[model samples]
Target: MRFRGLLLGLFLLPAVVGAYLLAGSATEDGTPRCDGIIEEYGDAERSGPMKPGETCDLYDFADGRSQGTRSYDQQRKAQEAKASKDGLVGGVCLVYGLAGACAVIAGRRAAPAPPGSRRRPETAPRSRRGGQAPPIGSMSTRTGVPHTRSTS
Candidate 1:
């Protein structure tokens, strides 16, 4: 039983881990090299009151700018989302895995009966002797009747 459970876990664990890993990778600010950008990048805390930084920029752009924010760090949200997504995937996989395991177990446990196997009758036993039990017919009291009649 434990071995089967382990196998099921093996089948589902990677998918769950992948979901978490991927969910954590979506980021608002990313690392991009811009050869044309003269602006420097600095940490929010390191830069003082007159802080200046460039998240992203390219040589050609009508807007000539990228997004900026006073406070924008998605590390916590990303981690939480990753963990939840992983847990969700794990849960779903677990359900299907458990179902498969149950089906396999039931199939293994049920044994097919051999040929000529007889089920017990619901009613009491009856006389197996063929032919009429006795004969009956209209006759005088002196003549003992022996007429044909159905047994069943």
Candidate 2:
């Protein structure tokens, strides 16, 4: 039992560790670059955040900048999705690890019987002839009636 518990713990340890790492990453700030800028490029010079030195001459009426960028809501939603996924995986791993540890501890503990405790005899009860049990439906010599097996 102890060996089996050890094996179980070893196998499930990775899952627990992975969940912790994922949850930790999810908790960090995930804000993206160029959040407030709302400039739709006419010629579509840039599709994402560009370097400060990069020249994008396309006129954007919204933010007056040519570089295209994601809105704040989009970045926030993506972060939330990642966080939720990580949280779910971490929760499952935590629960499984705890249950497995409990099982291992329980298996290692021995039953609390005293050293001199009396135990029930293992030998089967002997009939008058000191032989094996009679077959079912056999008539008893003393009763002399067909052995109608008791339902109870």
Candidate 3:
């Protein structure tokens, strides 16, 4: 039982650590940093593939004026989404991991029953509605009545 609990705790430890790391990346404001929209200037036909490390002059819709390079303003929306997803998964992992560890610890402390003895005494079977039936052990099958046993 102790070994089983230890194994369960070890298995869930990774999930707890992973969830902690993921949760760290989550934003408090819940606002996306990048929209990933590339704005095209006048004359779409004349526009060509922007070179690497090259800055394109573009209009800023938020600022209501034409401003700096498009490369700098370009949003990594995909990356942000991935981060958010990872954080959520991590949080879930952390919860399950901690819960599993607790369960393991609790299980390790419980006592095992002795051999050749039932854990609990058998009782009358329950009905479909959850009501207890008459005790089968003391009842007579032929007469459908309880047998009396006297101790004097």
Cα misplacement distance, residue 118 of candidate 3 (Å)? 21
Candidate 2 lDDT (Cα, 0 to 1): 0.58
Write the residue-wise lDDT of candidate 1 on 58-143 in tens digits: 33446656443222123234435655676666556556655665665665468454466775546632323375343355342334
| Worst-scoring 10-residue span by lDDT in model 1 | 43-52
- If scored against the real structure, what TM-score would every candidate get? 0.32, 0.40, 0.39
Model 1 TM-score on a 0 to 1 scale:
0.32
Clashes of 3: 1
Off by over 4 Å in 2: 11-15, 18-26, 33-70, 111-152
Tell me the spans in candidate 1 whose CA falls farther than 4 Å from its real position. 1-72, 111-152
Ranking by TM-score: 2, 3, 1
Error of 1 at 128 (Å): 9.6
lDDT score, residue 126, model 2?
34
Any residue pairs clashing in model 3, and if so which? Answer: 19-90
Q: Worst ten-residue run, lDDT, model 3?
A: 28-37
Any residue pairs clashing in model 2, and if so which? none
Displacement of residue 149 (Cα, Å) in model 3 is 14
- The alpha-carbon lDDT assigned to residue 107 of candidate 3 equals 66
